[model samples]
Target: MNRYDHKGVSHYEFLERLHRWLNPRTYLEIGTLKGGTLRLASCPTICIDPEFQLDVSSAANREVTLFYQKTSDRFFQDHSPSALLNGPVDLGFLDGLHEAETLLRDFANLEKHCRSNSVIAIHDCIPMDVGQTTRINNGGLWTGDVWKVVPILKEYRPDISIFVFDAHPTGLVCCTNLDHGNTILDGMYGEIWRTWRSTELSDYGFSRLIEEANIISTSRVETPEEMRRYFWL
Candidate 1:
C-alpha cells in the first residue's frame, strides 16, 4: 500500500517540488516564521513577517534571500513584490496572518504582481477541527480563518483555478489562472470580508467547505517526480 494512501507529503516537500519544477528566479513568502519554508528556495526570495525566528542551520542562505520585518499590510503599502523580483513574482506564498480578510487582501495584492504563469500558494487552508478554525486561536493545530478564502475565491473569481495539496499539518492551496489585470476582488473586498470575515465552521460545515473548494489531495501527486506533471499536465 502506498503511504500516501493514508498520509500526504509534508508541506516542505511539496513546496520544494514546486520550486524544483518552476525553477523561478523570484519567490516571495509572507510569514517567515522560523525560516523552515524559506530555506527551501534557492532562488531570489523575499520573506516578510513582523516577527521572524530564523534558523538557517540546514537551510539555503542565498545572498538573494532577504527578510523584510514588516506586516504584510505595511509591506504591500510601502514596497512592491515585483520590484524586489524586478519582474513578475513567479512563485508567491501567502502564509501570513491566518485571518481570512488578511489572506484575501494579500492574495489581491500578490495578483497585481503575477503573470499568466504565476502560481501563488496559500497555507493553512485545512483546519484540523471546528475549534481549530476559530479566530480565538486555541487549538494545538489551529488553522484560523484562512479556510474562508477557498470558497470566496471560488465564488467571486471563477476565472482562477484553486487546488489544495493536502500536505502534512494544515495543507497548501495553489492558485493558477492568474490575471494581473483583474480588479473584481479588490472591488468586492469589503463585501467578501463581511461575508466570510467571521466564519466559524462546525464539523459538518467544515466538510462542506472542502466540497465547495473542490480541493485535490496530494495523493494525486503519486511521486515527487510526478508533481511537475500533475501541476502542469
Candidate 2:
C-alpha cells in the first residue's frame, strides 16, 4: 500500500503557530464544523459552513465574527468576503468540501477577495494513502480527492506558489503570491473540472505527486520567523 508518513506537528498546531506569527487583520474559514481552528483567530473572522456545531464562546476573542450556515457556493453567491470583512481577507482557510471540484470552486471564489500578499491555507491536500483519496468516504481518515488541487494549481496557476507541509494527519497546502484580479482559474473552471473530475490518484500516479509536491517538513519552520521567510510572508 502506498502511504505517506508525515512526521511533523499537527495541522491545528501549525495553524495556531501561524496565527500567532502572521497576526492577520481579517480571517475567513470554510468548513468550521466545531470551531477548533476557528478559535485560533483573534482577528475579525468570517466562517462559512453548511452546518456548524460551534460553541458560542469560541468566538469571544474576536471583535467581529460572522457565521454563514450555508454551502460555500451559496454563501459566495449571496455575500462578498471583502464587503463582509470590510477589507480583503488577510488569511483564508479552505476546508469546506473534500471533493476536488468543490475545493477548486472554493479556491477561485476566495481568491477574488484576497490581496496579492494574502495567504490561503488548504487542508487535506495530502492524503496518507490511496484509500484516503477516494471520492467517497468509506470510513476513517478520509481526505477525499482534495489532493488533486495541488497539481491542478501547479499546472493551471503557475504564477502562484504552493507550499505543501507535512503537517500531521493529511497535510496543509499554503498558497501565496495571490492575484485577486487573475481570472485564469475562473475562465478555465469548466475545462479544469472536466479534466480532473474522473481522474483517480492511481491513474494520476501517486508517486509522481509525491515527488513533484516536494512536501516540506513542518519542523524546518518551527519558528514564526522561519515560517514567514519560507512562505515569503
Candidate 3:
C-alpha cells in the first residue's frame, strides 16, 4: 500500500531527500560537530554545540544559518530560534549528550518549538550491545543509553508518532506528529530521568520496549515505504 523505496540510502541521502522533497523553511540541529550533517539542511538553520572540531566554512556561508557554541541546556535556557524561523521547526536533529536524561531534556525543549508537522531525527538509538548503551563511554562508538529516550517518549508521550530505522554504526529514530502545546512531560524532567536511569533492561526488555513502542525496522521494506508516504509531498 506504500510507494517509496528507502533501500540503499545512507542517513545523509535520506536527509537530503527529505530536504529536497519537503523543502522545509527552517531546521535545527543539536550537535553540529564539523557540520557534516548540518550541511545537509537546505533551509534557514540553527546549529547548537558546546564545541566544534570541524571546518564549517561552507555551512557558515549560508547567511540564514546560525551557529551557537553552547550546550542544549544553555542554548534553550533563553534563546529561541523558532521565533526567527518561518515555521514552527520544519525539521530538527538531536545528536548531543548521548545520555537518556540529556536527550529527554533536549526533546522536551525541542517540543516547545515544534508543530504537528515538524519532524525530528535522533541518531544512535539502536546500540550494538549492552556495553554501548552504558552510561560510561567504554566502547569505540558511544551511544550512551540515548536509546532509552525513544521508549520514554513512546510510553509517556503517545501523542507523537515514533519510528526507528537502520542507519549503520547505530540507528536513527524519526518522530513526528509533535504537539508543541503538550505539557504532560513538563516539570517532571528530573523524576523521569532518575526513574529511567535506575531501570535496567535485559535483552528481552529491550525487545519488549521496541515492540511496545512499535519500532519497525527499515530492514523490512514495508516500514520504509510507509514512512515515505507518511512524509510524502
Candidate 4:
C-alpha cells in the first residue's frame, strides 16, 4: 500500500490561519467534538454535534455562539442555517460522519445555505493508507471512506472548485464557487451512494487520487495575505 507524506502544518493550524484570512462574518461547524476547531471562529458561530466534549467557555473569541447538541442531519432538519445565523454561512467546516454518503448529504444540505463565494471545508478527504479508508473505523486514526467524496464531487459537481491541502494526519478539502440553487447532487444522491458506498481506495486508484489531487502545501500559504491570494479571498 502506498503512503501519503504530509509534512505541512497541522489541520488545526491551517484552520486558524484560514479563519484570520477569511474573516468570516458567520461560521458553521459540524462534529464539534472537542471544539478544537470551533474555538478558531471569532464570528457568529453555530456548532452541531451529537455529543460535545469541549467546554463552551473556551470559545471566548466569538460574541455569538450557538450550540446544537445533535446530529448534523437533525440540526439541518430542525433549523435553517441562514435563519439561525441571520445570513448565509461565510465559512463552514464539515467533520461530521466519516462515511462518504453522509458527507455528501451534509454537503448538499449545507450548500443550499451558502452563497456562491462561501467556503466549505471537508475533513479527512485524503487518507494516508487504504487501511484507514474502510467504511468502519477499526482503530486509531481512522478517516473512513470520506476520501471518496473528493472524486464524487469532481465527477458530479464539476461547477464547484475543489482544492486539497496536504495538512498533517489526513488532508483538508476546501470547496468554493457554490451554487445554492443547484440540486444535482441532492437529486442524484441515491445513485452516487450506490456507486461509491462499496468502492475502496485501492479499487479507485489511491495513487492516482494523490497525483491528480495536486495537493497544495500549507507552508506556501502560511500568511493570511498568501492565503487570500491562493483562495482568492
Candidate 5:
C-alpha cells in the first residue's frame, strides 16, 4: 500500500478507485523496478524496462509479463507523437526514461490508449528528485522540455483535469475527469472518508490528494479502515 512507505499517502489509494470505475482487466507499467508498485495494482500487467534489475524467479515474477527493452522505442515507431500509444490501455503508468523527449514521446503513445475517462498516472513528478535531475544532465533535454508538454496538453485538450499528488522527492500526476464529458473546471475533491468529515476523503488516492492539500492541516496517520470507507472493497 505504501509505495516506499516514506509516510505519505498510500499509493494503493487510486487503484481502489480504478476497481470501481473501470474494473480494468489489463494493466501496463513502463518501468518494473522490483515490481513494487506494479504488483499492488493487482491486475495482469504488460511491463517494459531496459535495465530493471528484477529477479525473474522472485515472488513478483508471476504477476507480470516482462519486456526487456527501452520502453519509448518499443512503444512508438518513427519516434512520432502520433505513434505513442498502442491502444485500449485502461491504466498506463509512466516510470520509464525520464528525459523530456522520452516523456513527450511516451505521452503521445499514451493518447492512443487512454479512454475518455482513463487515468494516466505519471510517477516521480514531485518537484525535484533523482527523476527530475537526470534530464538536466542531458543539458536539460527532458527536465526542461518535458514540462513543456503540460502547456501543449492544456491547449489541445482543455477538458482533462490535472492533479498533482503532494509527495516530495517523488510524486504522481493524475490526469482524470475527462470521461463524463463535462467541460467545467469544477475541482472535485475526492471526499474519501467514511464518517464524512468535511476535511477527510472517502477514498484512497483521492484522499492522498486531499491529505496533500492539507499538509498543514494535521500530521495524522490514515488507517486502512478509514481508507476503505471511500473506495472499493
Candidate 6:
C-alpha cells in the first residue's frame, strides 16, 4: 500500500497495491497534467482534461474531480455527460489523447464505461523506433501511435493480458487477463501489457531493433574508451 510520487518508480508501487486490493468506486483519469497522477490516485477521481488549463483550485482542494472535454472523440462522440458515463469506472487511466487515432479513440471511448473487473492503465506505450524522433504528440502519449491500441485490444478482447511496466518517463500498459483469471481482484492479478508483430516490424526487423537499442544505450559509462581514453584525466 505504497503510492510514492515524485513522478517515478514504475507504476506507483503496482498502483498502490492495485488501489488497496480494488477498493475502487470510480476513478477515471485521462490525463490530469499537473495533478501528479491525480495525487497518486485512490478513488472518486474523474480528471479528463481537454486543455483543462490547470489552476483547478489545487485540483478542487484535493477532492479531485474535473472534466473539460474538448475532444475525447468529441466527448464520446456527443453522447455527452462527459460521455454518458456515470457508473462503474473503478479504474481507467489512459494518459489522454495520445495519437494513433487518439489512442485508439480513447480505448474505444472507455470501452463503454468499463466494469467487469475494470482497470485500464495505458500510458506512453514504449515504441520509439529509433531516431527521426519528434516528440510532442502529447495527445498520443508521445507517439509510437500508442502501440496501435494493442492489436485493437487483442482482436476484440481475447480475455486481455498484456504486460509491460517500465515506468520510465511514463510507460505502462497492463491490461490484466480478465477471464482465465476469473475477473476482479481474484488472486490479485498482475501482468501489464505486451505483444509484438507487424511482420515483426521489418526493414531488417527495424535494423535489429535499432541495433539492439544502440547496444542497450551504450551500455552505461565507466568505459566509453574509459572516458574517451581519459581526455586528460
Best lDDT among the predictions, by candidate number? 2
Report the number of the highest-TM-score candidate. Answer: 2
Task: List, residue by residue over 75-187, the lDDT tens digit for candidate 2.
Answer: 99999999998899999999988999899989999999999888999999988888898787898989999989999999999999888899999888999899999998889
Per-candidate Cα lDDT values, in order, are 0.79, 0.90, 0.74, 0.89, 0.47, 0.50
* Model 1 C-alpha lDDT versus the unseen true structure: 0.79
What local lDDT does model 3 show for residue 181? Answer: 82
TM-score per candidate, in order?
Answer: 0.90, 0.97, 0.85, 0.96, 0.56, 0.29
* lDDT of residue 93 for candidate 6: 76
How well is each residue in 1-233 modelled by candidate 3, as lDDT tens digits? 11112233466665665676667778899998988888787678888899976675645535588778889999999698678675588888899898788888888899889888788888887665555677888759777888788778877988888777655656677888888888777776776777777765554366565455444545453344555665632
lDDT per residue for candidate 5 within 23-136, as digits (tens), equals 555566677777665665554556667767765433353453535456666745533221233335567677777654466556556655556656676665433322333334
| Alpha carbon deviation, residue 200, candidate 5 (Å) | 36
How badly does each model clash, as a count of residue pairs?
0, 0, 0, 0, 13, 14
Q: Give candidate 5 misplaced runs (Cα > 4 Å).
A: 1-7, 10-23, 55-66, 78-87, 128-134, 137-147, 177-233
Once fitted onto the true fold, the runs of candidate 1 whose alpha carbons sit more than 4 angstroms away are 1-6, 57-61, 222-225, 229-233
Q: Which ten residues in a row have the lowest lDDT in candidate 2?
A: 224-233
- lDDT, candidate 5, at 175: 66
lDDT of 1 by residue, 1-233 (tens): 10112146888888887887777778899998998888888888889999989877423656577678999999999998888778888888889888888899999999999887788988888765556777877748777878888888989998897888778877788988799999999999988888765567763386686566555777787655666654541
Lowest summed-lDDT stretch of 10 residues in model 6? 212-221
TM-score between model 1 and native: 0.90
TM-score of candidate 5 against the unseen true structure: 0.56
| lDDT value, residue 73 of candidate 3 | 94
Candidate 5, residue 33: how far the Cα is off, in Å: 2.6
Model 6 agreement with the true structure over 101-135: per-residue lDDT tens digits: 56655665665566445667787654544221123
Range of the 10 consecutive residues with the lowest summed lDDT in candidate 3: 1-10
Better of 1 and 3 by lDDT: 1
